[model samples]
Target: MAFTQIEDYGVIGNLETCPLIGNDGSIDWCCFPHIESSSVFAGILDDDGGGHFAIQPSGEFESAQEYVTRTNVLRTTFETDSGTMTLTDFMPVVDGVELGHTTSAIYRKVTCTEGTIELDATFEPRFDYDRVGTTVEQTSEGVIARGNGEQLYLWSPADFESSEGEEEHAEATETLRADETMWFVLQYNDREPIDAADCAALLRETIDYWQDWTHQCLDASGCPFEGPYHDDVIRSGLVLRLLMNPQTHAIAAAPTTSLPEEVGGVRNWDYRYAWIRDVSYTIQALNELGHEREARNGFDWCLTMCHKDDPGEIGHPLYGLHYPPEMVEEELDHFSGYRHSKPVRIGNAAGDQQQLDTYGELITAIYTATDYGEEIFAGEWEVIEEVIDHVSGVWTNKDKGIWEVRSEPKHVVHSKALCWAALDRGIKIAEDNDFDAPIDRWKGERDTIRETVLEEGFDEELGCFTQTFEGETVDAAALRLGSVGLLPFDDDRMQSTIDAVMDHLMTDEGLVMRYEGDDGLPGEEGAFVLCSYWLVECLALSGRVEEAHDVFESATEHLSPIGLFAEEIDPETGEHRGNFPQAFSHIGLINAVLYLNQAEPGETLDPIGRGATEITTDSKS
Candidate 1:
């Protein structure tokens, strides 16, 4: 099997879970039942033990892949020596508003568009993360691969034969002329077998469903985003939605884990779990783009996760998708890593670490969604108060920062700024709704946090706000002060800090690094993509419109062909690093575009809202 670069894959999902379909026609990585579940196909991580399902031309062929317009359905064209064939891939969904709640089946239709072409289909599933082998059993309907309490059934119109001894693997070879079509359906869990006609009908319905949803985005008239990357913005929004869990409305940071921040390095971590701070950022971006309903759904999901039976035991920085409290880190020693990036991790330890920034993120998300006139339940309001009380009590202490640093605790500047934001937004929420208690106390704490950040987080000698209190390390998080409303974007102090961070922490290739300081990690990582977008937003807000445009262009120049981005980018190689199709990166992109477009002179733009709260059309004229 030929291995492709991580960027060569396009993602297709059922809103429950997704699979990464490579340009070469391979489903590289996928987790079923839920995003965090063990992968049935882990070839993206370990080609041998990590089984894969692939359909491609038998002979050598050149291939190109793309998503069907306005939908998650993917189409890969294979040009063989004698002919051409196209493979259409999508997970089936029910009709209407129920489209998001999808069935556990992947529908693939293969057709020859040119002369006669020979096609090959391979089904190899790794059960229990390859801890056990799946035994393939042939039946009248098709073939079923069963192992470890998971059963994946395959039904195809073409003849199937056992490739390995004892029918451990199933393969099909068929020749089709122009206008000929064949169907393959891969079903997981409890599902009824379907025929080719039903598969074709479901495919059409799925395409229509996605197309209608994309049309509903803010792209209609009065939509603010009209720029060089308009289509990219829409596509990123779709990718973010694809990462969301339909049942809980909780969004995963990414679909895959252990893809590596640096090849041949140990920076791999599982990103399938939901992080409160990450979801909060995602919601804010969606809300700014006029996807208010989706944003509120996500925020409401976070509220539900935090509000357990015990109100005192409120929120954690991160949680598993199904099991919120038990995020135990585990290493898979049996499987090889992606391109030799070692120690494939399962769960995240960051869930247990006390990151003080989460409170502020939750409050800001709720306040932003509510400000958009979306209704908030009384139960949500109670959770908001509990979070506020928690922040007021714990802002002074620090365990882990936003980066989830494994180092000793220090007063991280970003965490403190977020704590201030929590109080600041809480006060605003209280005043806006006239629902209150401890108004003066909240005000004093907010002001105290502001003063402390100004005094201790800033380094006069360096002319920038440091990463931690009284520390000299410049970080990209400083650029976010404007977004959180902690500082005026054009304030001289803030400008100095931005300039300093860009000067010291940015790569020669114009990409921003998260931080240049050591955090007890072994290998060096790539420039952070989210931070690059933050620089874009910060520059636009500070009145450097042209510079911001230039920076935005440079930052997005090397994204995936489909405009997807990973968490980080290697400046030298221009390859995606860390988890692929990262939510934070796309969220940053959408918010930055909104900030730039809404930043016209005489028009005041709210960075959080991503649009003018008041357009001031008369002043513009």
Candidate 2:
């Protein structure tokens, strides 16, 4: 059997957890309660050995799929030799609505739309990645999946005959004629697992809950981003939220990591971790679209998980979903990574690195808390001040830049600019709210960073700032100079830097490479999607609307058939690569949309790159 590509999986989830459903109606990956939880279907990891939950026609079939309008509900229809059938997948809301902290459940309804079709319904609920034996029984509660570490009730009204099966595979069959239907519900609860017979009403209620939640998203134009593509964003945002840990503020970079960008590349690693750089852009995009809660939660989660040694000791640039900075990266002993990209890791090693921008991003998020008219919790603000104080002490000494390059560290311009923003916002807080901060020290450091960039980082011959003080080559991340308000969009230096990056690092297709130097890797990879979006922002900021549109249109062409983008795009083949449905890529799409929409003169738009501090928790609203 051929395995589906990573891009082929459709996602559904509540804010707390998600499941990946292949077009063939097989759920290959799902973690209850949170993305980092033990998988119910780790088949995406082991392919043959991993367990799965599948409901598809037994015979050959034609399949077509789409998400429910403006909601994360996914519908896939299969036209089999016998008949046509449809399956709609969604999560049941706790109280028939989503507000504050909420729980989630995956509910799937299968129905026949044509002549009699013999279909199959099979669920092999594997706990802790199929590492334990499980017992099943058709209780009054539904299909109970019990294992050593966990217990869950799988509720179904489908015509299913319960039987014990092997850990790796399970099966059930149903012959349905036209207009026939079945409903399957999988409810996960620790204290009160769902115990019931028929959940048709609950299924309808869940569907209504999702539809109602979609209504809350009012785009800037007073309508949620609509059309075929709008559904994609809504679905993506919905799925990404599942990566959030509801009790905590943590949101994973991806639900699973070490799914290689290129098949057979050992670069595959776990993504169920948080990165400061990734969420910085995520906050802005989610905020612009009116998802304020998600934005605030992302920032709060980051602050709670991060810890520092002494003030001078670098705080981690990233963290695990569940633990603090010291969490050891766990490598699976049994299963190979997706497509046999071996050494599948569980925790993030990036946690211990000294990416200088994390403090800036955290501070910006704090600043955003005030800007959006939300409050950073009292305890969290104290931590924010601690981090800002640490930034104040180390603003000038460069460790790692925002890209987290493995190469030797240098005084990267973007990282330096971020430090300036940290100090700038820190001073802003001190003035606005009468918080006692080392305002003089912060201002001194901020100005020092600016003067250092102007004097040392600028390359006179190239007419732009270099990536790092000692580096001669231009980098694409320098394009953010305009966007970050380190300098104005129309400033000659900003224009030169954009042109320099475009001239040196841009591919023939206009995609941007992250840098010119070796990033501790042996060879080059695909152009980063975020960098390309930054190009569009820089283009728009400089009054190059036509050029910006050309760039934006070209980037959208890279989305997978399901209208999702990975982290990068291959330059030669134009194939999508890196993590599928990457947060950074979707965030890039939203940023580009905003920039493109603002190109018209009478829109009364604010300057996109004008004095625009890094979009943080404070900025989203």
Candidate 3:
């Protein structure tokens, strides 16, 4: 079988890991045990060697996928000439139950709603990204696949037959009539057989769990849940929720990695780990949606992972869910890449890069949480002080900016502005709570950084801020200066910067590219989806509500039919690129919608935290 289109897949997860199920009823990508663990089924990456599990109608059929209302339970309907069948897929989640107490199982319930339909089920488990050999065994209860010291048990009523060749797999066939149903449960390292009754109960509980969780957005006293883009906001919220690890509170950038930013390019990198910048963005969005508990948990997790005893030692940009400091990049040469995008990678080497923007983003996240009435622990405050002091000492240094370019570090204006934001927020926290050390020094550094950015970062000839100090190139990240409070939204320089980005970095389709400059990598990448949303936010906050709405609608029109977004989009083809269901993209969508909904027709809005809080207050009133 050929590779499925990246947008043709729907995601379902149990907070530990996620599986991408194509509309054709094939689970093409899944990482078991943990989101960062080796793949159990990775046919999406390599159509030939990477294994997959599929259940579909025997003959040609039309299929469509959708989520059960306000829930993550996915329902894919197949319509054939003879009958119609519905496949309900979900990883069962129960309230109040610890993740360790339950078996991490994927439940697929198939129901024949009309006439009769014959279905084919194929189970191929490729442990360890298809590098380790796996053996399939038939059992009385179901089937088992063992490899790389890991075992997967497939429980079903249909009698599955195991193949005897080198590329081993199991196959089964079932025919169901009207009102008939069948169940398939794949568990990790567990042999407990689950019947149809168990599946039915679990399905109901899972639906309730998601629906109840979603309802919190609407039920929260001060959130602006009722808006023109309510459905889009809710779906984006759900996607962001799926990327969060409930056990570890670490929010992954995406589940599957190395999906490529371009079809056959080398821009692929593993995003299964949590980055401080990404997590901070996710927390701010969750806070805006009134999901304070999740926001607090994510913030706390980031602090716990990045905390250091030495004041001078700064944390890495990203870390593993288990809090590993370094993620050594490795390539899997055995399997073919997605669409032959070779050199499929496992870990992210960029984790160790000096991304100075993290200090500002993390401090801004802390300030936002406190604005929502979340108290900062004493130790966390100390860490914040150390971080601010470190930023004060290093704001003049050169480093990789927000995009994590692999080129030599430069004095990125955005990074410097973020460092200024870090100091500004740190001083606010210290003053707001009467917990202080050296406010005068922080203020001095903050003012100096601002003046420096305004002077050296701005290009007089371009009439806007450039990507680097004294550079002449425009970057989409410059659009964030106003939103981060580095400048007022209506400031002449800020407005000119926004126009510079739109004219230089935006595609014909209105999607924004990160930059047109080289990033020390080969091959071109697609227009970044998150950067496009940043444009939407900038436009909205600057009182250009109609323009913002137009850009937002144009960008969201490219969202998958099921409302999921990848990290980037091919502007020419409107196809998704990069990792599937990116948290950054979804977080951008939520914040953009909130900003658009709150912006007045002729007045500039405040920066993110303050502006978002005003909407909550107005909604409550």
Give candidates' CA RMSD values in order.
Answer: 3.8, 4.8, 3.8
Instruction: Please give the TM-score that candidate 2 achieves against the real structure.
Output: 0.86
lDDT of 2 by residue, 32-91 (tens): 767767777777777876667889999898887787666667889998777799999877
Each model's lDDT comes to: 0.80, 0.69, 0.85
What lDDT, from 0 to 1, does candidate 3 have?
Answer: 0.85
How much is 250 displaced in model 2, in angstroms? Answer: 2.5
Residue-level lDDT of model 3, residues 1-621, one tens digit each, is 889899999999887788999999999999888889999999998998799999999999999999999988999999999899999999988886335444589999999999999999999999999989999999998899999999999999988999967899999999999989999999998887578888899999999988888735555355564676788888999988888877778788999889989888889889998877887787778987777788988777756644766533443577787655448999999878999998799999888788788888788877877877778777778877888899999988889888888989999999998898888888888888888669999889988998898889888788788899946879888887887877877788888888988899888999999986777898999999999899998898899999898889889999999999999999999999999899999989998888887888878888567322111211111
Q: Provide the global lDDT of candidate 1 against the true structure.
A: 0.80
> What is the Cα-based TM-score of model 1?
0.94
Pick by lDDT: 1 or 2, better one = 1
Model with the higher lDDT, candidate 1 or 3: 3
Question: Per-prediction TM-score, please?
Answer: 0.94, 0.86, 0.96
Model 2 misses residue 189 by how many Å?
6.4
Instruction: List runs of model 2 lying over 4 Å from the truth.
Output: 96-104, 132-148, 152-168, 187-198, 215-236, 298-314, 323-326, 375-383, 460-464, 522-524, 572-574, 600-621
Model 1, residue 26: what's the lDDT? 85
